[model samples]
Structure formats: structure tokens, C-alpha cells
Target: MASLSVGVACVLLVLCMVVPSLAAVYTVGDTSGWTTGIDYSTWTEGKTFKVGDTLVFKYPTFHTVDEVSSSDYSTCTVGNAIRSDNSGSTTVTLKAAGTHYFICGVVGHCGNGMKLAVKVESSSSTTATTTTTNPDFSYSSSNRSSFAAYFITWVALIVILVINVSLWQEF
Candidate 1:
């Protein structure tokens, strides 16, 4: 019985540590996706963004996701984008606790309202559950790998729990 209790406690401790680090993933622009003319400012409302969360921009080949400085974002300056990608799907991990700016680099896109600004709070400030902009969202490779690893960890934990239960019963 004592051994079973100790095993259960260890499993619970491991789960507690791992659960807090699991980051939430969001799809930019929600159901409409990343495109011009949609009001991005409204999309970020009611969402609590935190450091370690991910922002996935899903758009067409003709469009681009550009991370930019606050000044550049305000002016729609495509030339000075901090980071740019036109791969159709851009996965951005929020690494800091500050406002992050993004825009579409294509000519006139940002001016036409293809821009997003998200305020990321420190993880220590709050905890939010994993979420998505839409019900239908796909994971990138990094996300897939991370999920697989987490699945394996849970399976191992369950096996340990079962073994402990069996041992307890035998004793």
C-alpha cells in the first residue's frame, strides 16, 4: 500500500509540472484566416495571451506574415519587417511578455487592414487553457512532435499506475 501511494504521488507530481508548461495554440484571424479587409483588432479581444503561446498564421501563397516593430506596424512599412514568411502557414511562438506586432507585407495589404497586434502577458501573470481561433486547425511539425512526446509520457504514467494498483492488490 505504501509503495502504491508513493507511485501515485510521483505520477501526480510529474503531471503537475508538465501541465503548466503546455502552451496554447491559436489560429490567426479565426475562421476567416489571415487575409486583408478583416478587422484583426477585434480578433484579439477576449483572449488572454501569454508567453510560450503560439500564433499560427494561415494564409494563401500570395499573402505573407510579417513580424514588425511597433512603429513599422503602425505605418504599414513592409520594407523594414523584422521577420517575413510567405509559406502559407507561419507558426510563431510568443517568447516574451510584451505586445507583438504583425502585418501583411504585400503592397497595400496592411493598409487595407491585414495587420495584427497581440499583447502577450507573462506566464507568471496568468494561466490559460489550450485554444484555437477555430474548431478546425492543424498542427505544425513541432507541435506534432511535442504532442507525441506528451502522449508517450502519459501512456508510461498510466502503465505505472496500473502496475502499482496490481501490486497493492497482491499485498
Candidate 2:
């Protein structure tokens, strides 16, 4: 019935409103990626990192991504690394709120400024995320479909409500 369709549309509208937006994906070092000679500090400056955001490190086979402690990061020591990835294309998710340190495991790479230190927040503010666009980084293209679906669902809900109201008046 028309009433059933309206009810389903209303439910979809609520779901669209309640569901949190997808987390953002940031390309580390931008076009430079995780490599030597690049100023990782400058790249991360002024950028707000939050839990659930992803860091994609694209590099060559000779380099490696090593997650280390703050002390190890300062000393460029790979002996005590917490995690090491040599896949060249590494994706790391920010799972917790705190300072995270990453360095290149290859000798002298970290010393040459191939290291990064990011302070991630627990969660981003939900109030200002209706459109979910980050000024610092480009959003994922896949998220566009989600936003489009949300908009269509919202409009359908409004139309359904209007039709239901008019039908009520006729009875």
C-alpha cells in the first residue's frame, strides 16, 4: 500500500541520518608518498588526524614502513619497532587516540627525514559532518554514492509525507 511505502521511506530517512559517515583516507606525503628527502613533518603540519582515518603510504620496494615508539623514532632505531611493513604500498588505520610515530626502516632513511609523527584525536566532531568533506584531504570517491543515496532518500521521505498529508485531508 502507499502507506507502507511511506513508512519504509521514513525508516530509510532515519537510517541515513543516524549512520555515521565513512572515515577519511589520506595519502601520506601526498604525491611524494613515504620516501626519503621529503619533509614528513611539514606534510603533516596543521592537519587534524582522528581515529578511524587511514594513512596510505606508497613507496618503492627498497623502503619499509616501521611503526616505532617515540624514543625509537627520535633515535631512528628499527631494532625495537612495533610493526614493520615492507609491502611498498602500506595502509595503516588510526585505531586509537595518541601520538603515533612511523619511520623508514632502511638505514639512514629516517635520519634523512623519512619519518612521521601524528597526533590523532579520539573521534571527530559529528556536528559538522553532514557533507563529510575534509579541507585538507580529498574525500574517497566511493563515498560519493553514499551521499547521493542519502539525499535521494531524504527527498523521497518529504514527498511521501506530503502525499500522505493530502490524502488524509481528502478522507
Candidate 3:
């Protein structure tokens, strides 16, 4: 009975520790034909995004999501870049707080105003709230945690079963 109690407590503790590191999914680009540029005209900017928020690009053409300076387009040559193809999706995790810029790397795309900007607010607060209500954008933080918990639970259950079977001389 004591061993069973310990096992239950261990399982609960593991689950508690693993539930919050999951990745959330967020959609970028416009679903409707109204927004013609790489900019997230269909989405909101300057929202609070946690560390695990995945920005999904749902555009119909190839585009690059690059972090750039807020005022100068010359600094656009720097920062991390993600190139997504048409009808394809790329999930990028927000690691820090700052304004992230995106543009179409295709020839003359950026020059033609195919650019978008996103301001990722700091995620230091434990209870940060987002200000956008766009249906195309969504976020979830339990993806990684849920997978980890499921994996751990299965492994533990298998190990426990094997041990019990061995003790009962059934193996």
C-alpha cells in the first residue's frame, strides 16, 4: 500500500511539472484575399506571446519571417529568418521579447510592400494575457507537456507491470 501511494504521488508530481512547457500554435498571414502583402493585416500586433508560441505562416506564396529594426529597413538583412512556401506552414518559437519583422524574400516582394511586423511583448509574467481575438490566430501551451506526460506515463506503467509480473513469477 505504501509503495502504491508513492507511485501515485510520483506520477502526479511528474504530471504537474510537465504541463506548462507545451507549445502553442498561432496563425499568421491573411486567410481572406483582402490582405495582399506579407504583413499580418488580418492579425493583430504588439500582443503578449509566451516562449512556446508557434507562429504559423499560412500564406499562398513563399515569404520570409525575419526579425528587423522597427524604424530602419536597412537592418532587415539581420535576424533569424524562416522561409515558408505557399500553402505550407512553419512554426517558429518566440525565444525573446522584441518586435519581429517579416517580408517576402522573393525578388521585389519586400520592395513592393510585402512586409509584416509583430511585436512580441515580454513573457516574464506568470499571468500574461494576449489582446488579439483573431480566429486565424490561436495559441496552445500544452503540446509538448502533454506529449511528455503521456510518454512518461506509458514508460512507468510498462516498468511497473514488468516488475509486478516478475515478482509474481509470471515472467
Candidate 4:
């Protein structure tokens, strides 16, 4: 019984660690206007951002997403600048946790209040499960989601076996 408890505990621990490391993707721009841009006035921060999360900047016009300081505009230090030239997509990974300020690097753009700010909080130790539902589950499609379900089932079986072994050890 002791062995079984240990095994189950290990399985649970592994699941607890693996689930949160799964990175999430966030959109910085959409059809209406630039998200996390000067025109938007403000950008969603903190909880919306994670350590390994990627911020995708998608905009049509020439704009820059620069990380700057909140206190001083002249102290503008660029951290991650995404120009519209890079295939219309720039992905930035959040590495550190703190309040980050950004703005357009275009001439006269930042001056016109094209600045944005965001606060990145430290990652939580607990893992949270993320569920994504496919509204259109096509039976004919050979997509990643279809395969993922099978993979998850297989993993679950392995976990169950581990738990059983641990339980048997207790006896």
C-alpha cells in the first residue's frame, strides 16, 4: 500500500509540473486595430502574460511595439521592438517579470502618445489545466487535436499503471 501511494503521488507530481509549462499564445493585434499599441490606449497586462508565453504582433501599417520605462519617456530603452516589416508577425517571449512600457519607434509617433504599458507578473508555482475546444470537429481532418486526444489517453493509461504498481507495493 505504501508503494502504491508513492507511485500515485509521483504521477500526480509529474502531471502538476507538465501542465503549467504548456505555453500559451496571445494576440497583440487583431482586425479592428493594433492591440498593445498606442492607438489602443492600453494593453492587457499581468495575468494575460506568462513567462514562456508568446506575444504575436499582427498589424498592417508601420508600427513598433517597444518596451520602455514608465517613469521617463526620454529614458526609452527598447527591450523587444516588433516592426511591421518582419512578415507582419513578431513573437516576443516574456522572460522577466515587472512593469514594462512600450511605444511606437516611428518619428513623431511616440510623441503623439503612441505608447503602451504592461505588467508581467511572476509565474505561479501551481499548474493550471488549459482546455481548448474545437467547435468544428471534422471527422475527416488529420489535425493535431485529433492526435492529441489519443496521446492523452495513452498517457493516462501509463499513469494508471504506475498508480497500480505503487498500490501493490504497499501490500
Winning candidate number (TM-score): 1
Runs of candidate 1 with Cα error greater than 4 angstroms are 125-140, 144-149, 160-171
Off by over 4 Å in 3: 29-42, 45-47, 72-88, 106-115, 126-171
Which tens-of-lDDT digit does each residue in 1-171 have in candidate 2? 576667777867766775545566678999988888899988988888887777888889899888888889999997677878777787777776777888999988999999998877768554223222211222233343456568677877777787788778879
> Which candidate number maximizes lDDT?
1
Better of 1 and 4 by TM-score: 1
Which 10-residue span in candidate 1 carries the lowest summed lDDT? Answer: 130-139
| lDDT, candidates in the order shown | 0.78, 0.75, 0.52, 0.52
For model 2, where is the 10-residue window of minimal lDDT? 130-139
Show how many residue pairs clash in every candidate, following the order shown: 0, 0, 2, 7
RMSD of 4: 10.9
Q: Kindly list the per-residue Cα lDDT of model 1 for residues 57-157, writing each as its tens digit.
A: 88898998887888888899888877788889888888777778889999899999999988877788465333222112223536634784787688687
Clashing pairs in 3: 24-140, 39-116
Off by over 4 Å in 2: 1-20, 124-171
Worst 10 residues of 4 by lDDT: 132-141
Candidate 1 yields a Cα-based lDDT of 0.78
Q: Model 3, residue 44: displacement in angstroms?
A: 3.5
Q: What is the TM-score of each predicted model, taking all chains together?
A: 0.77, 0.66, 0.53, 0.49
Segments in model 4 whose C-alpha atoms lie over 4 Å from true places? 1-17, 30-42, 45-47, 71-87, 111-113, 125-171
TM-score: model 1 vs. ground truth: 0.77
